[model samples]
Target chain A: MANSKRTLAALVYNRPGVLNRVASLFRRRGFNIESIAVGRTDDPKLSRMTIVVIGDNATVEQVRKQLDKIVDVVKIIDITGDDMVSRELALVRVKATTATRAEIVQMVNIFRGAIIDVGSNTLVIEVTGDEDKIDSLLNLLRSYGIREVARTGRVAMTRGGTIGSIKAEEEAATGRQR
Target chain B: MKLSGARMLCQALINEGVDVIFGFPGGSVLPLYDVLPEFQGLRHILVRHEQGAAHAADGYARATGKVGVCLATSGPGATNLVTGIANAHLDSSPVVAITGQVARAFIGKDAFQEVDITGITLPITKHNYLIMNASDIGSVVKEAFHLARTGRPGPVLLDIPRDVFVEEAEFNYPDKVELTGYKPIHQGHPAQIKRAAELINSSECPVIIAGRGIIISDACEQLRELVEKSQIPVATTLLGMGGFPGTHVLSLGMLGMHGTAYANMAIQNSDLVICLGSRFDDRATGKVSAFAPAAKIVHVDIDAAEIGKNVRVDVPIVGDLKVVLQVLNTLVNSKSRPAWLEQIQKYQREHPLCVSSEEDKLLPQHVISQIYELTGGDATIVTGVGQNQMWCAQHFLYTRPKTLISSGGLGTMGFELPAAIGAKVGCPKETVWCIAGDGGFQMTMQELATAVQDKVAVKIAILNNGYLGMVRQWQELFYDKRYVGTPLWSPDFVKIAEAYGIPACRVKNKKDVSAAITTALSYDGSYLIDFMVEPEENVYPMVPPGASLAELMEHPDARRANASSTFTVSNV
Candidate 1:
């Protein structure tokens, strides 16, 4: 089967070396990670990680299982091809001449992006959207010579309220349930 | 209470119920050595080398089902433990390795005797930690033990800087670990268990391939119940020898590359393969494309990654084998397949493993059989990697769980002696035997001093063939009899044992083998016996690499004569 993109969110303990544990697993398994983003969750002790990978269903399922094996990982949910809200933040620095600045700003405005910084011959545009919208915006700015691009890989959650909160609560209810 | 980091480490180990540790002291771990005398509860076995310490700990863990502890210093000390750590990891042995690093300030400066021990061990360990502060010692130690012993047990590492050991801090051990991500699933899904049961009950030809998980999960009884209830034949992986009684009527012995011909035939002909906790390693399943072609495989393992990593599993149940088997035993119906049994008998009759009746010279198989006869297959046999391990696995019968403690997955040579010491220490009353090849015994022979010093009464059996027997067999079979780098020279093992202040003997004749074993068994303390056996002997029923299990060659010449005969007359 052809490989498809898979976006998975994991709630982990906010402890040092936890990220290394997760990252090392992927490196050790030789899994190609497209993008990853980590940030503190609503709970102070918990951190949420969004990881995008490209693989077949079996490969993605294996990645999910391997991630769950890490001691610091709390919960993992795959939101691929589901009714979910997904977004990616990209900071693109384009080589903007005076002639292309107005056109680039109009394109960014149309894509609902913002101008984060302005330089003599460059404009840093910040855009947050699904991968498709971000790709479309970046494609339009590519003609203006994109200097550099930084993206916080896709983060996703189910559209109908919290998907993992109930699971986490049930997991907590069973102390060392094995 | 305020305590130094070294004191905190000792207390934390004590809290985790660690009574003994195998270690070799070095420059970086001097702080730990200095404070070691203060703790009365923990006994330290000083090993000759860092690698010996790790293997000994691994052996202890495999024998006792407890997290074995080993300590080493930084840099070279930590580096030397890599092979043993990897051995434990591959074999699923629970071992906690602690190493001392350079002072905190000099960690990244390439200070003397400093190494990134954590980074070196990251891939091999289940998990690892580098302690920057003394206060974290308790929690780290707790977590390290927890991780090492829990769900698909493996080795864990803890690298502590020297400064952390000297720095004083208030000690508070956490009462509970709150790792949200570390839960191992123990219960099989009800639907999956039912499906497995249905497959088991309905299949006409069912075979069970048991693995090390049976011993690790303490599921031998459950496995036996399921097998007997379902009337399924059982074939064990190398490490899974004692999981099912080898003497049972339904037992097909070890299955794999050098597996019994009958066992391989059973697997090839079965309709359903119930893989309980055994990963279908390449050695076990030669040419996966042609392995068990007629069977629908049902794999039950604790680690989800092992399910479809090698062979595709039809019904995958990810959970503890004990729990899964318990549920399966209830769901399975008691029934017998007379036709299946008759077919297995036919295979067994056609390809019987024959031992030479002529006894002019000693044979390795005779020695193992004599050991089995004398011990009644009750002794815990630990073997170093080689033809000796294969002979022991094929000849000796294991009826008890955790009785055959060999390095299986890693095929690590030099594992038997130190591991025997650890096994003896772990199970003090059991008769522990270290069956090793002459080449492998010489690798860690220095550990004989540790065995004598610790007063561990482990009997040593060296199958002295004067060559790296297994490699010699391969060279003869595959490399056109070019015996390059296979011949070995060794120190007089009897003299070496005597130098260690232990009683020793040598058996050159076939008739003296039993007497020598009896003498070693009757001796009160440690004993070593070097059995001079035939050098040119080779393990048979080997499915050459990448060949189907159905194409097992009983001997090198048989492969050519029977190349086209899939089910023909056996050479034996």
Candidate 2:
């Protein structure tokens, strides 16, 4: 079976050791986690985590079911095959000289990347996009001698109207009646 | 009113309906031990080792469908409970292990006797908690018990700091837990149930593989009803022994590696396999690709992750076994297959499980059969790993649920003595027996002192073969007659039992076996009987590792022909 990348988002209770529980579950099951990002959600008591894993459809389904077994997990959504948008933040430092600086700036502008930091011989570029877009930009800048790179794995959400938007519409109707 | 953390913990346990606890105290648990005496509602049994404490609790839980409790201190003491915890996890036994940690201030400072217990037990435990504050003790205890006992029960651990035990906190136990993520599916899908019923009705040759889940869900009556209604022959996993009455006409005994030859053949020949609550472990399914190859499997389990894990199922119903079996009984129509039953009978007659009475030496099977005859298949039998476990599973008949307690999944060697102690404690009125081999008996025989001191009337039956029989059987079959480290040197079990202040006897002849058991049963306290049987006798009908269930070595003569030159060339 061909392995494909999957993005799963989970809403969990904000408590101590929740992250460890999720991470250890993956480690124990021998599932390699590509990337994981966690942050507090709109609800103060709940936190949302985005995990990028590489496996077949069946393996990913098993992971979702196993995650649902955890007491601290509130909900899990596999947004991989859904109509969704994903973004990854990457900061890359490239060796730039007076001669290559202008060309690098033009390449960054083409990709809509921002120059976050400038040292005497290095320029730190911040890029946010889907994995392919980031990879393309990184590839274009490799000739300038890439010094270092750091990426905040992929975070994703459904593209159009979701459950949150449906709730908002219900609240709006009640507000009009009031 | 304010109460110390230890007192609050004791109160929480009492509130959860806990009456007994198995524990071994250490430096980090001193504060809890000091306050333990005040709680008269809870009785504590001091075990010889932390491992024994854990296994005893596990056995108690298996005997009774309640959460068994065990306590230990930090570091080495907590680490000693690892094997027991893993055993309970694998078997889905409800056990709550409480470990005392270093004081709060010394938690991360590499304090003496401080080990990351929760971290060590992360994979084995269903869930674990580290209590940093005394105020959360009540709710944590409540949650731990609820988690350990509810839907697909498993082991849970709670590590408390020493300072937390001494600190004062207001005790307010929670009335109900609100866990959003841990909802277990109890009701099966109506469509799936209908599909399963259709498959069961249409199939001419059908077999039911009942597993530990039937016992865990307390669905023995539902299972028996379903089997009798459908007229499907039932084969139980090792842990599922008592779920269906072994003496029933349609019962095919245990299935898998060391299972009955007829049972394994019936499964292989069946057109439909209705798996209830039992995950098809590698031991149960000889070779994954060839196991029940022609059968369309209907698997029902509470845990969704277990579905399609090892074997693909045609109709998968994720729900509690009791509810699923209840609904299934109503949906399934009455039917019978005389041809299939006749075929199984033919298999049974062709390769019957029998020992020749003409042999002068006493066989291990005779000992088990004698025990069964003496107890009328009513005693709660607990066994350690290896040949003794397989022999007991084969020869003894279990008529009631929770009657056979053994470490099935983890295969812990030293489980018999401590677990039997726990089993006796759980059901004081019933007769409990620990059937162990010489190798495994020595591993945890130290717990005999605990049994004598506590006055637990658990009969000890040691099948002393002088060698690690199961491994020796393998060596005899596969590794050319060389024994290697399989042979053992041991102390006299009789003297050992006597030293522990327990009555002891030895039975070397077949005729004396019954008298020894009768004498052991007569004693009100613990008693040990060392039954010296033929060391070279092997368990037959073994499906060699990686072999298909269809290919089983039926007897020693059959093995000798296929075995290397070693067995055939050597003296019989």
**Whole-model Cα lDDT per candidate?**
0.89, 0.89
- Provide the lDDT at B163 for model 2: 90
lDDT of 2 by residue, B1-572 (tens): 99999999999999999988999999888999998889998889999999999999999999988999999999999999999999999999999999999998899898999899998998899999999989999999999999999989999999999999999989979999766677788999999999999999999999999999999999999999998898999999999999999888888888998888889999999999999989999999999999999999999999998999889899999999999888888989998889988998887755555443334577888888889989888899999999999888888878899999999999999999999999999999989999999999999999998898888888999999999999999999999989999999889999999999989999999889899999998888888999999898888678999998998877655433333332221100
Off by over 4 Å in 2: A164-178, B356-358, B557-572
User: Quick one: best lDDT, which candidate?
Assistant: 2
lDDT of model 2 at position A5: 88
Please give each candidate's TM-score.
0.93, 0.95
